[model samples]
Target chain A: MKQRERLIEALLALSAGISVLTTGGIIVMLAVEAAHFFRQVPLGTFLTDTQWTPLFADKHFGILPLVSGTLLTTGVAIAVALPLGLIIAIYLNEYATVGFRNVIKPLLEVLAAVPTVVYGFFALTVVTPFLQRLIPGMAGFNALSAGSVMGIMILPLVSSLSEDALTAVPRSLREASYALGATRLQTAMRVVVPAASSGITVSVILAISRAVGETMIVAIAAGQEPRLTANPLVPVETITTYIVQVSSGDVAYGTLEYDTIFAAGITLFVLTLVLNNVGYWFRQKFREQYE
Target chain B: MSNMTRNRLLDGAFRAVGLLATLLGLLLLAVFLLDILRTGLSRLSWQFLSALPSRFPERAGIYTALLGTVWIMVLTALIAVPVGLAAGVYLEEYGRKSRWSALLEINITNLAGVPSVIYGLLGLNIFVRFLRMGSSVLAASCTLALLILPILIVATREAIRAVPKTLREASFALGATRWQTIWYQVLPASMGAFLRELFWPCRGRWAKRPRCSCWGCWPTCRLRQKAPWTSFRRCPFKYSTGFRAPSRHSESTPPPLLLCCCSLRLG
Candidate 1:
């Protein structure tokens, strides 16, 4: 009996070890290469420089331009996805009949399962052509097109999370609001939405993190022009696009140019780590329980 | 009367917009599938599927990528399935009420949310660099294994928990050992549910066509069927074109068992 228990325990330990080893290995490797990067290029230069011409002799490595571009596209994606996702979530969770939601939810999930590269293709083939007709100089590969496609890609995530949060709000609260002669919209907006506010906020943050970390869409659609401009019409480079570009190019692994990818990766890693930490805290702290 | 009619108009407008949004989402999917079909149909011959990637633009195919994807998924399922089940069983049976187990459960949930590219970084370090796998199929497979392990364990645990506890009590009363009771009573009873859970997370990955197969790969020609052309040949019917897949497999190896496994999982 003791031997059997010991065996079970050993198996559990082995599984946990796999998880830890995989996650830890990533952090350690990034840190090693990123440290090497900092040694070659000053941390101040990497963090503060506005220009990102790393290959040239007078290389300015301030990552702000790339960071700003990422933020701008991410900002647009969230702005578009959030309200639209909320409306869909409200329609499904608050008002829709079971049959309607059954059809809509799976359709949305299938969209979510479609790869990011597919979304990039949609942006290139569909969104870009449409946008170019409307805006005279809208470049073929610009943040606006990328962000719109990304917004569509992330719609399911935001809606699903928000729906879960909204559903978890006690039915009794909505009932009480209705009992007081509140309209369906009024009850949902006043009673349920506030109660689920923290969960909804966390959902938005997680969706933003997903947008920030997405690689293939930005790599394929957003051109690698790291200009520090907020205008979405112009081509701009993101940190993720930069990572994909640097890795896919023919640079030798140990070269300074190659190490720059690691550095940019580290920066993206730190940002996502912080977002994940905050999102984790919100989820743990605000998980609503009902009898 | 006016206010009521106005309210009705507003409600109708809102509902229309709601329905339109839903249709728009569905239409996007339809358009995507239509485009893939439209482009890929002309190239959907047996030779296109069987041929290898070639620098000669006309001779390229997804043969290597399809093979690589199969290899990776098969190895991933092999590595992940047993470990995930055991860990899940341990958590459900032995440590169900333990605080550490709960903490580990929460950690796994969060880990599943981490981006897949992060898994690429992890694979680069642990599998490629540390283990010297050299960016081969093994590294990619193990990386994906780690990515799906947490999800598998969670699902497995849920399945185990859903098993009835009365059977365990009944077996224990009949002098069965705890391990024996769990093995014979709990595991067998929950086997179907376990399989259901095991396959769900992986369905998305398997069904997805690997992007490496499509990007920058040269196009290969598909068979173009020629209509039967003859004057005074057909009595009353018009000729039509109907292309068919090449009846050949000698040049190309058959897809591995893993593709079959994916179909099984989907089933």
Candidate 2:
């Protein structure tokens, strides 16, 4: 009996350890491949160079264009998601009836659950045309439409997280605000919002991280032109998009060109890791205060 | 009285904006569904369902793609569920408050946040190249299994944690081993919550198409070469480029594109 118990424990522990192995694998694979890439192209050029055209004969290996593209789209997505998500969260937590909140919350989550490829198609076919009419100079494949659709894709994530935060705020705080003759909006905006600020901040940061990592929508809608421009009206290629562009083609394995994806992948991995850790730190601090 | 009226108006205005904000998600969903239905509803005939994808847009159907998706789904579930469940059980039932366990917990959370495309990179490197799986369905399924493992582990932990402490204690007093206690008492008790939590990962894996593309599981490639007859080794690909193709073949592509949307809704 003791031996069987020990055997089962070992098996279960091995299964649990797979997650650790996965992380190690990601780190090692990216590092090894990226080391190969850096040996070919200097790290300074990878960092400081403005252009990111490796496939072309000119062969610039700068990562700035991809980084800028990522920043711009992520900025646009956050701009759209932060306010809208907060508003929706405020409405659901403070104003809506329980039944309405219950129904609408799940429906909103369906927005997130929809395949991003579908959103990419929507951005390309539906949104770009609409934006073109509204903004005459808008390119067929521009950051604005893709970023907007991605914002909508990420909205549920923000709203749901923010809503949980709002719900966590003590009831006494709201009642106290009401006793001070505060209106519903004033109570929601001032009392609950302030109290839940940390959670909301965590959500926004996490959403930004998600937006930064978003691939399909940007790949399909935002043209694969790696220009160092912040203009939402023009085409740009994000890091993920660049990775996709390389991977989908028949690039021979172990080549410097193929190694660029890993280099790019590590850059992406680091960026999101920082953001996630920040969010984690914020949540830990917030939990200490509340719990 | 005038100040009160002004505040009331501001409150009402904010309320209106908030309501509109809430409705925005529903509004977009409505538009997407309506557009897909309007364009693709007519093309849902049996021929469209059964025919192989052809160069001629009129003859293209989602038969191979659908079969591929089902294959991927089953395989991914087969791999992910057991491992995820075991991991969750270990964390909740067996893990003591040690530094190692804490590190493990944080690692899982971080893994969950790593982008799906990065997982694609990992899949391409480890599964496709290292293991020589050659972009087959097994490689894609293994990749997705890893992708969704964190989510499943978290869900399983939550479900197992929700199982009352008393149940475990009772099982222990009855002279059951820890494994038996977990398997018979805790797992059965937590089954409902566990199943509910399982739905999201299932839906997510079903909807996950981009990773397939990353694995080089293009539908055209899969269709040209007959996949191995064995269930485990089949080449399943999601038709991600179908949306892009319609731009050139506008006349014949909308139906299949719309069909994908409809099927997505059903899934």
Question: All models, DockQ values?
Answer: 0.14, 0.43
lDDT per residue as tens, model 1, A1-291? 779857767776677656656556667888998898899889988988899977668877889998998998898889878988887877788778889987787567555555455456557657888999999988988999889888887777777677777888988998998898665666677888888887788878877887888766676577789999999998899987776566545667788887887788788878877887788787679867666
Q: How accurately is candidate 2 docked according to DockQ?
A: 0.43
Model 2 misplacement above 4 A: B200-238, B247-267
Compared with the true structure, what per-residue lDDT tens digits does model 1 show for residues B1-267? 676566556555655666666677677767765665554456556665566655453565545555554555577788888877777777777776677676776666556555565666666667666787655656655777777776667667778888988989999999887678878899898888877655442222211111111111111111011122211111000000000112221111122122222332343
Show pairs that collide, candidate 1.
Answer: A49-A62
lDDT of each: 0.66, 0.78
Candidate 1 local Cα displacement, residue B262, angstroms: 8.4
Predicted model 1 interface RMSD: 9.5
The CA lDDT at B221 in model 2 is 19
What lDDT is reached at residue B115 by model 1? 59
lDDT of 2 by residue, B86-163 (tens): 999988888879787788899988987888888888888887779977666777778888887887787788788788
